[model samples]
Target: MHQPNKIAFFLFFILLIPFGVQAQGHEVDSLKNELKGHSTMDTIRAGLLIELANKLTYSDPNEAIPLMEEAISISKKTDWTLGEALSHRQMGNLHYVLGDNIKALDEYQKALALSHKITDRQLQSSLLSNIGNIHADLKEYDLALENYHSYLTTSQEMGNRADEIKALSNIAIIYNDTERFEKGVSYLEKALSLSKIEENDLFIAAITNNLALAYKKLDENEKALSLYLEAAELAEQMNNKYIEASALNSIGKIYLLFNDYDLAETNANKALALSKEIDAVEWQSDSWEVLSEVYEHNRKLPEALDAFKKHVQLRDSVVNEEKKSELTRKEMQFKMERQQAVAQEEIKRQQLVKNGYLIGAILLLIFSIMGYLLYKRRRDALEKRKLAEFNAKVAETELKALRSQMNPHFIFNSLNSISDFISKNDIEQADDYLVKFSKLTRSILENSEKKWITLEEDIELMKLYMQIEGLRFDNKLKYHVSMDNSLEPDNVLVPPLILQPFIENSIWHGIAPKKGGGNIDIRIAKDGTMLKYIVEDDGVGRSVQNREEKKTKDSYGIKITSSRIDIINHLKNTKGSIELMDKAEGFRVEIKLPLELQF
Candidate 1:
């Protein structure tokens, strides 16, 4: 259950957001009467119109729409540029709240274009965040990030602590959504620290609330609850219903977690009343969900069902299915393009293999003809030539297979995740991600093009791969890398990018689908003249996983790895084999390869 936050950035004092109208302690009907009476003063009328629009934005957006349109037209006719801009900006926020992302973007752009007419850097900065938020909602992350950075940088230049914290908090939201909770927590901590300096109750409540949510995602419920309590108290002191309601709803969930039925029910109902008081549809939905959970666990089946139905009704009414479909189509198209690029790369590799075979045959034929002409002296040359041709073909095919081991989707998603850290101002975390990303990419590029790499390099590359995957899974997927003490990894030689596929299989197939996440163990030990590499996971057994995979196609990586192993066995005069076992609780894979050493 998630309570909603306004997508608009907090307005700075000196330069009020063109769209901002803090109409507090005033009734909507009174504002309408004021709008009706101030016709001659276009500025006053426009202001009243915007105030009504802002108030209705969260409650009854349908009525707010025509009011904002009338305000903009009247303001333009009266040559009130700022009023017109404010109308457009507020209109954008209204659309965002209603889930009309396309119209939201258009209105935000119009606001931004008009922002150039005014010298209010603060309003302009807020517009950047509004633009970024809409882009993020549409899953256009790159554009969203660009605007968020602009928001942060603008506030930093202006030295507004409030705006800076707002930017940080919002950027952390993007991180939380992307499952980069560790980095998200870092960002939230920074924002919370800065906000504490300001001693602004409303700002403090907002940041701590976000921090609580980030901690909750990391499964640190105690920390989450503590922060939520602090946020609730701060929000109450400021008489802010939005923050107070959000905190109460979150607290109710925590209570549910601890099975405190009475406390959960009490807090959820309080939050529900507050949400309804403010006409916060999203928070009202969240309240219903928490209440449903409390009822369900308390064995009040009828109440639970009723609460659930209300929650779904609100959620379904707010979410626009057409926008969801459009976003899905865009995502699908992007994936298809990426897959096509990978396929085209494979085609090139296949053509290279064909060329290698043709070239090898031609070379062998030329050598054989020469050997026949000088049969007495070159008898040994023919045998050497034949072996060279075979080795070359094997190496070429192995190279192609090695190159295929790095999935483009994995690389793109990893890189995309890193950008979230940057936006949140968690530069340290961003740097750490970049380091791991650099190691992974460099290893793939360098080793895939090589015939063999030191076992030490191979193990290091595998560790980096697992570390990156561990981050993707929010560290819920634990992994271990260990080797026998006697095995000198630097002296031992192995096929390049060899262990990655098996480890990847354990991660994606074995650990990832587990409910609470699982662990992977990669260990290497000496077994006679061969090195045994074991990959194991505490997840669904292979038998169960296979059963679940009935409609899914088999992985081609395994086939490629098997073929590469066969080639290595024949060329190196060693036995190599891979075995997959379905363990009682999970899956285990072992790869046995003859130990080859470099002098």
Candidate 2:
């Protein structure tokens, strides 16, 4: 076949059938028998018509064409999509046989679209090959190559080596037509290898022929002649006159090129006879051209001139006919496009009106939802503010009650210490003690007025208390207070008197009972987002557990402090509490505060 250009030898392989039939006549007879028993509207009847059309595609394609069209009508009425697709494909095959490639392509595309709707991968693969061949015939190499690759891939995946070899040969022909002789050689080699392994004479013939053409293009005339002889013999064995004619024509040209006038004339006359027998116009023209060259080399001017004239006449006629076909196809396409454009414009105008109403309705719904959301959020915010204010007032009231329980006991103890100093006639020490005690009292009193105080103010109060105790105990009680340098004391907030009771309990119950009065160490640091306070005394632990029971008046400071912490935790949803530990040598109090920053 002339693929990319006229007189350019290339393989234009038709896709092989999926079903295996022994004889076309037998298949057509069987389908006709099946159709005769079924009704006109019967599904079996529709399938029989399409199958019959396929069976007659080579022998009598004109008869097959109407059969395919009838099958399509019946399948459509029955809603048989696969049948419809097969009918279109059958028609395409018939049209392609008649060389009506434009109509063939239209039918192949319809079949392809329908094939995708079903799960028949074989049908889809065949449709792609058919479409590719039509494109190749029309010189649409890019589209041809695209569909050919798809066909080859599907054939490989399906393990259809016959179809694979066929696809490879066709693709190689396209490369040869485009003058990429090396690329053509590569594809043809692969196809030839596969064909030899498969041992299929028809496939081997097709690849060998295309490979020969490729070698001929590269000036490997000896190699080309050998391959052409092999292909001609194989095609003869398979009774494929088309490939046989192509092989002979190529051999004749190679002979003509090498100045073997007698041998070239012999091959060219034989090729022209076979082409005439098969009614292959293109091959006939090729044979005529080869004869013209051979005769001219032999110095037969008259015979050469007559042969050249015949070759020119055939070539020009073929070229002009193809040009006419292409122009007709283009004209039809232009008219169809104009009709489609008018329809699209109408649809676009209608869609514009529809979209306008849809947008208006959508915007109205959006604004309505926004208004409702805004009103709901404002009401929710006001309710949350009221609840927060109520919680604060309740926490404040409960805190005031706790402070009242904690303050008097410490003040009373300090007053007694001051009085003892005066009774001992230590006036200077008494004055110093009195001043520190008053300052401590003022700090406690000021902190008692708030629900929460800055950590800095709280720590200052703790220091004041420690100082006053040191003065009263005559510095017998040593203390260590360590604070984290990273802590922002002025920014962090804690409830008033939260840490005081723990320190006081450690001093009175643990240290005061001991004679030597061991040191009280307070370590304050941040543990992630929580504050940690470690108040330890090495005086005594649970060994003095019973000492609290023997006290004249029970100091309920520890009990009251625990109750206040529990209430604060419940109200604020925080983890703030104290843990008492009594080790072998000392008692320790661990206090954890959920640190809240002033901001």
Error of 2 at 139 (Å): 2.5
- Please write out the lDDT profile of model 1 over residues 1-599, one tens digit for every residue: 00123442221211222233444425777887887677775788888888888777766878889999998998899998888888998898787777665677678778778878887687788888887876676666677778888999999999987778877887787788788999888887888788778876667777788888889988999999999999888878877787889899999999889988799889889999999998988789889988877876775655655686587567645543433454443444344444555576567556655665668858766556445545632454455455555555464456447445656567667766666665676666656776797677766766654778899988888778878888778887888888999999999998887777777777777777788999888889999999899989898656744754721423567777787888888877888998877788887889998888898
Number of the predicted model whose TM-score against the real structure is largest: 2
Q: Using lDDT, give the best candidate's number.
A: 1
The CA lDDT at 261 in model 1 is: 78
Query: How large is the C-alpha RMSD of every model relative to the true structure?
Result: 19.5, 39.9
Give the Å shift of residue 534 in candidate 1: 42
Candidate lDDT values, in order: 0.75, 0.73
Enumerate clash totals for all models, in the order shown: 0, 0
lDDT per residue (tens digit) for residues 1-599 in model 2: 11121222323333333244566567788878887778678678887887777677766889888788788998999899999988888888888777676677788889889989997788988888777877676667898899889999999999988778767877887888889999989988998899789877777787788788788889898999999999999888877777888898888888767877788788789889989997888788999999877866675644655675577557656754664565554444444444455576567556655665667868767557556755765575566555554454454444444445335556556666766766686766756776676576556656655778888887887877878877766777888888999988899888776767667766766677788877889888998867888888887655565755723232455556666666667766888877777688777778787778888
List the lowest-lDDT window of 10 residues for candidate 2.
Answer: 1-10
